[model samples]
Target chain A: MPAANGNNAGILKSGHDARLLSRSNKCGNTSGLAPGYVQTNLIVLPSRYASDFRLLCARNTVPCPLVAESATPGHWGKIKSHLLGIDGETLAKGLDIRRDAPKYNVYVDGKLHRQDCEDIVTEWTDDHVAFLIGCSFSFETALADAGLTPTHTARGRNVPMYRTTLPLCAAGVFRDSTYVVSMRSYPASEVERVRDITRPFASTHGEPVAWGWDALERLGIRDIDSPQWGDAPLAKIDGKPLSSFKNNEAEVPVFWGCGVTPQEAVMRANLEGVVMAHSPGHMILLDTLDVETIRKF
Target chain B: MPAANGNNAGILKSGHDARLLSRSNKCGNTSGLAPGYVQTNLIVLPSRYASDFRLLCARNTVPCPLVAESATPGHWGKIKSHLLGIDGETLAKGLDIRRDAPKYNVYVDGKLHRQDCEDIVTEWTDDHVAFLIGCSFSFETALADAGLTPTHTARGRNVPMYRTTLPLCAAGVFRDSTYVVSMRSYPASEVERVRDITRPFASTHGEPVAWGWDALERLGIRDIDSPQWGDAPLAKIDGKPLSSFKNNEAEVPVFWGCGVTPQEAVMRANLEGVVMAHSPGHMILLDTLDVETIRKF
Candidate 1:
């Protein structure tokens, strides 16, 4: 890994730059790393599970906005963006999917067999199909552009995610899984504006699924500090717990359908063999801009 | 049939009002009838052709935005709109689909078997599934709201439609069919404004697929006044042939993906059974407002 305090301070210039940086680095969280680019959540499953998983995405689009997928099993050189007629580079070329993301998770029989592996080239086989699912990071540029910076971004941590009671519409062999969401606390006054700003990014998660503390609890999120995936919300900036930040009444927690929902659903399936996914916060960056993903309204 | 010179002069107050009128009147064109409601192109095929047809829509979204489909074959109680999380009347309820549209068309062996039939409830079967395709009429309200009225609407005639050389993305048996488009003319100076106003209704065929008189001929159109479907453009509105209107250097034709493209594709499929569609100028009115369909940005 590069030195902790050098010119490569987290953020990179573009998607192409980020990909080059990612190929050389050890596994790390990808949040706030590549701005204004389409970052995707990766899921690799056998051809047997591909149809069922596709149905799962179609039935539950909010939590799983299907972006691109392997045209055929083991064929991963190029994939087309599902969004039509957008004027931009829809194809990501000349990269290794096995090592493009900063980190990866390998699940065997519904259990985590390997966590944060740098690459999975050896594990890949001809039966494998890679699905590039849309990530919330694709719309973060809009949020930042609107001046509603996410609390996690301000604190330099991964977004906090939670499991919820929202049941997913099931498909064959993929049944009985609840929804998952990521939280971003913004000033209470900005909730409507936040929803309005993010509303056009439908290819991503679009608008907030829930907006207040009670709404979050109603969805079965019991704790605000703890998260099911990614890093816990950082309470301190310099060295002390953020007593003032935690008690700020003007701030409210907003939730959007998280990419973790699909990952969790695949894990719950517990297929006969193994499936692959991006480790929490490590996403595949596409060449397209975040604005290009916005619905043209 | 109600007298054409009565209080109801083409337009109705609301969706409920329009439906009540539609029920009592003999088959007629629906152009400019219901001012602000969503209208749809209807298509019904056997369950055997449903999956492939669905893929066809998913692939060619610009030409075929699948709004809603029968939940099960011949089961048409309710359909959740494909659009995600818009706060509006997304559900169409309690209406008999077979008799609702102003006129119906029956097809057999890829040929027009009947035209302008009032209803086809007797021909309905449990094996058939209905698809409600988005109509360009959904975005016409935005055009009028922006002070750019459609030429066909102003002249009180059906929009001119043409079969084009642009081929659709083939799916299963539904192959080798070219595209069909609806044409509307506006002042040459207003093309940009027209494009901007209608860009939001992505569920409808978003914006103009092409904008200019040359684009019409390039798509293999020999006569702008004559159309393959719907009424021929009435060049002479008041008196004399529209030599003046035709020569007006300011006006130009704009083309959009017409609902006819999918209907044409289904016909070309020539499945060994009957197919049903809304007649050329007739449409099914939905209980949602026109603005509700606009992709929020």
Candidate 2:
């Protein structure tokens, strides 16, 4: 049996076990919790917009690589290799999706309505479809194992994300949106190796799409310290923005397609419907191995 | 300009030109016509069944790798780089999808209403959505260029396809269907080379799923000479069913996911709504190259 710590008793020793730890400890971040297992971004939309959302993910594969999805409107456990359901070998008995995650963000008519909640069982409906998107957390373990921990991870801060000038390929009613990218600065010399390490994780945004400070200007980033979501870099010497660390001389910021892009697109589309997502940094841990998640079918 | 041997004029010297050639010559097989351009399988379903079909394609990507789709109901050429309308450069001034293909197969309520027809204009409705699935014809050119021509192409016969025991992952009302695979035979020594050559064209069912005579038994294939669709192998020596060839001493049978699979599933589902598809050897030729078709976002 895999070792379990914190509140976890039956689950594998992973970021998932740590997430259970966070839930009991009143901590919200699920990032860096499950190491080898896949972590997924969550988005629940009404069945009316499900097809369009599916099309959106297919068109924008890099930013929105679908991991598993609800087979029917009301079905949650139908994901073939799920972690939190009864049909497959589940993490817990009698699992309820609405109450499982560390935190939830509720949106009404595409506007942020609730910031953080322990559970959203009252908000969910029978006509809702849940989508699981592979998250950057799935690939961070590989990067760390290769001795290239992301700068944000090393500094104990959430990864910085920015909206880019790159427009997404439109699908159906989902339209008029730009890609959102997460940034992690690395030594300029190690950029190629960093790309190589992350290249196989295509389901997790694959390799960095842009590199260096020039990329910041190209992607229209005015400041590196202030992100659209998540905590800022650790060091801000005398009110001046630096990299994630205090001494950031050799680092160059690299950008990867962010999981927040679909939510951003949903908010921009402004559809007259409710969409729910996991709070930023709070993701759903899955049973699938990271290698299995990236395998070509 | 590329050479145009058959009745092709004004069109670029590629699949588009051959489709024009087939249009005039009343020819159905587009097996060896265009060398570099992409060829696609066609399936048109009512908008009511469109979402389920899209999900089906997503779940069973190997057999139903979607190349392009109608932007909306009743639209034909909204694909970003299409070959059938005015928005982008198209084949003819006013291309009608109903009358374009060399032959059409009309299925009414999951029953074959017509085997072959020059045009499907009489059966078309405004609510239909057209789907273009990438076909193996897109990658055969590369195999030939690598000096590993498939036996079906060498003998000028339509590729033999079989219904396999491999059950497709179900989605929505589309259920209870098995995978359809097309077979080609080559020397045992060249299987790896063949796999290498076709691996890049993932949209067109990259690489064989099974190989050798044992694969036939594993897939529950009782007969190799008699197939569900397309012409039988060119020769059957001594009335013995050979491996897509006569002398089977060194030949090894290789199976690829067939584009005809979605149609098989539709037929099995026994959907009340009629679905339309191109006749087996008559495909829709697109303007995009095989390389462009396989490119990731």
Predicted model with the maximum TM-score: 1
Q: For each candidate, give its TM-score against the true structure.
A: 0.52, 0.51
Question: Looking at model 2 chain B, which ten-residue stretch has the lowest summed lDDT?
Answer: B1-10
The sequence of per-residue lDDT tens digits that candidate 2 reaches over residues B213-295 is: 77776567878888998767643223234644533646767788889998888778887776888888777776567776553
Per-residue alpha-carbon lDDT of candidate 1 for residues A1-297, written as tens digits (9 for 90 to 100): 332113254667677666666677643566766678888899999888887787667656677888888767886555555765642234466656787887888887778889988877878888888888888977777887777777667666677789986656454566668779888777667877887777667677767767665665556777676778865665433423222355454666778888888888898888867799888777878777788777632
Error of 1 at A52 (Å): 1.0
User: Per-prediction TM-score, chain A only?
Assistant: 0.89, 0.84
What candidate 2 gets wrong by more than 4 Å, as runs, is A1-297, B1-12, B21-25, B80-95, B234-249
Candidate 1 A-chain TM-score: 0.89
Q: After superposition, which runs of candidate 1 have C-alpha atoms over 4 Å from their true positions?
A: A1-10, A86-89, A234-249, B1-297
Which residue pairs in candidate 1 have backbone atoms (N, alpha carbon, C) closer than 3 angstroms, thus clashing? none
The DockQ of each candidate is 0.02, 0.02
Interface RMSD of each: 18.6, 15.3
- Per-model C-alpha lDDT, please? 0.72, 0.69
